[model samples]
Target: MTAALDVKGLTTRFETRAGHVTAVNDVSFAVQPGRIMGLVGESGSGKSVTGFSILGLIDAPGEVTAGAVLVDGVDLRQLSTEDLRKMRGRKVAMVFQDPMMTLNPVLRVGDQMTMAVRVHQPMSKSDALQHARKALEVVGIPSPAERLKAYPHQLSGGMRQRVAIAMALLHSPSVIIADEATTALDVSIQGQILAEVRELADETGAAIVWITHDLAVVSSLADDICVMYAGRIVERGTAEQVIGGPRHPYTQGLLDSIPARHEPGRKLPQIPGSTPQLSRLPEGCPFQPRCPRATDLCRTEPPLDVRDGQAVLCHHPLEGV
Candidate 1:
């Protein structure tokens, strides 16, 4: 089956006083309809940059240097600016980390949502509002009609987020890029939203790319997983394979750091050292400086190793347990 979204060899760079720093280095992944792919990594690992690059949102000082972003087999990279803007909400939509980033402090929920719907589709205000109300209902918001009349500040954080998500659904986008959409909510509310997101994918047949640093969240929510280090995906596989049997040392370290995987009283383990500075990354493998399995062979660039539908970019990958 053709992927709903396919990203190939994506590379994004920022021109700084020092030099060009590659923020997203040859990253690639695909998501099929009704499936959720978790793009997991530490901050500065390029997960968020990858999301923005896919949507053609990279600006000034930063440019998408290479790659093809295909939505429904059409290369988004080739579209004119006006055409790309048209495709953003109709074919793909992004839910930002902060609901406020997508909401207007001065506008009522209904007003913003109806505006969003009418942007891509010419329709009567009432018709657009009906679409907005249904979207809120789809995301499990109660009293959708009443809530639409309320201002953003009038609602709780979770409710505001639900409104933001509802707006993303106004167009029934084929692909949704959610950048830490649930990180701000309390655990219970986050769980509720994750469950609703799963249902939304199944019901709407929308491919979702969930970008987050929290492995615990993705372990429960994602069908597939991509573990990133620096700007590259070091490992890609089903959630079972990546979370349950991580091959790359960075991935293994991330899994080990999850507190739930350890005893309650014991201290949590952590990946040693921090994410590398993009411009000053090591000569070869970016993770080599922090990787325990690194050897002289690792000083040279590692080739992509594929086995049993799992791929790893490591000279000495851990054995599948």
Candidate 2:
């Protein structure tokens, strides 16, 4: 089956005054229609950069140097700016970590939402407003009509996120990238938003890429999981395989760090050492410094090997079923 989104050998780099820094290195993944894939990693892990690269949103000093981003078989890099702009809001949408990134504080909520719909769609003002109102309602906002009239500042954080989501759904895009979209909301509100997003995917058959640092959130929402470290994906598989039977040391470290997985009195286990600076990455495995399983062979880069359905990049992957 054709994928809704297919990314192959993607590498993004930033040209800083210090030097060129590789942010996303040879990353590849696929998201099928109506399915949710979680891109999980810590801060500076290039997870967000990969999402931005797929959307062609990387700014100056940073660019997609290699690889193809195919949306429904069309290579996005081959499209012109005008074509990309048109494709973006209509075929693909991204929900950013900050609601402000989507919401304009000066603009009234109704106008913002309606404008999003009207941009890609040719509809009368009244019709667009109707569509926007319905979208707000779909995202579980109460009194959608009243909420539309209020400015973004008037709504709470959760409400603002809902509005952003409603805007993303305005055009019924085929793929949605949520970059830490629910990170700022309270647990209850986050759950509500996630549920709404899941329902929307099921109803519309939209593929969803949820990028987040929270493993627990991914475990709950994603059908598949990709674990990244230092711009590279070290482990990827079905959620059950990645989360239940993690093989890479980095993946194991993440699972061990989760408080709920530890004994009540024991301290949470953290991966030793910090993420290496991009320009000064280690000679072999990026995780070698912190991995207890690292051996002499680990000093040489390991290929991503497929075992069963899991893809793990580790010279000394934990041995077991």
Candidate 3:
């Protein structure tokens, strides 16, 4: 089967008055149908930029300067504006972190969802609304029929996000890019959404790119994970492999820094130093400043090393299985 999404050598950069900032550098990953791939990273780690670049949504000073975002083997960058617009909701959809980004404050939920359907298919309002209601059901929303008449502000945050997710699923797009769509929700709500999303992807055979900074969430919700640091993926592997036996120092640091990993009273481990400014990144690994195992060899950028179904980018990765 063709991959649902394939991003190859993606490099997104921003040209600012100060200097050029590489937001996503040489990132490559593929999500097969029915799989969830977590794009995990810290703030300014370029995970979100990767999402925007894949959707051809970057604008103005920022651009996808390299690589291809392929949907079922077709490059999105090659599509014309009209074609791209048509392909967006029909082939690939984005679930933004903010539900408001997807919702129209003035529009009724039913109207917004029905419009999403009609935008890609010629369907009557009644038929489209049926689909919308079913979508809400799929996302576990209760009182779906009555809620359809409500406006965005009438619902709680979790309800609004579910509506956004329902809208994304209304088209059964081959791929969905969820950029921290559940981060703002409480832990229970976030877990519910994550579980529902993973189940939906499996049941519908839709690939999902779940971008967030929470390694714990990804560990439980994703099949595979790519750890990003300073605009580049420092590690990639099966969720269990990466989380349980992380090879790259940065990945290990991320795992260690999780609050749950430490004893209740002990200090939580954290990567030292703030995220570096992309425009002024050192000549070596972006995580070198905070990496405990950095060596002189790290002064030069390390190539992504692929071994035994894992990719590690570091001069001195952890050894011993």
Query: lDDT of all predictions, in order shown?
Result: 0.91, 0.90, 0.90
List where candidate 3 sits over 4 angstroms from the true fold.
Answer: 301-304
Which tens-of-lDDT digit does each residue in 229-315 have in candidate 1?
888999999999998899999899988887778989998887778888888988778889888888877778764455457888888
Clashes of 1: 0
What is candidate 1's CA lDDT for residue 185?
Answer: 96
Candidate 2 per-residue lDDT over residues 66-137, each given as its tens digit: 999989898998999999999897888999999999999999998988788878888898899999999999
Candidate 2 colliding pairs: none
User: TM-score for model 2?
Assistant: 0.97
Query: Model 1 — TM-score against the truth?
Result: 0.97
* lDDT minimum window of 10 residues, candidate 1: 300-309
After TM-score superposition, the amount by which residue 84's alpha carbon in candidate 2 deviates from its true location, in angstroms, is 0.3
Residues 1-321 of candidate 3 have per-residue lDDT tens digits of 788899999999899998898899999999999999999998999999999999999998998899998999889999998999998998999999899999999999999999999999998999999999999999999989999999999999999999999999989999999999999999888878988998898899999999998887898899999999889888888898898899998888778887787889898887888889988887777777777888777768664465557888877878624
RMSD of each: 1.3, 1.3, 1.3
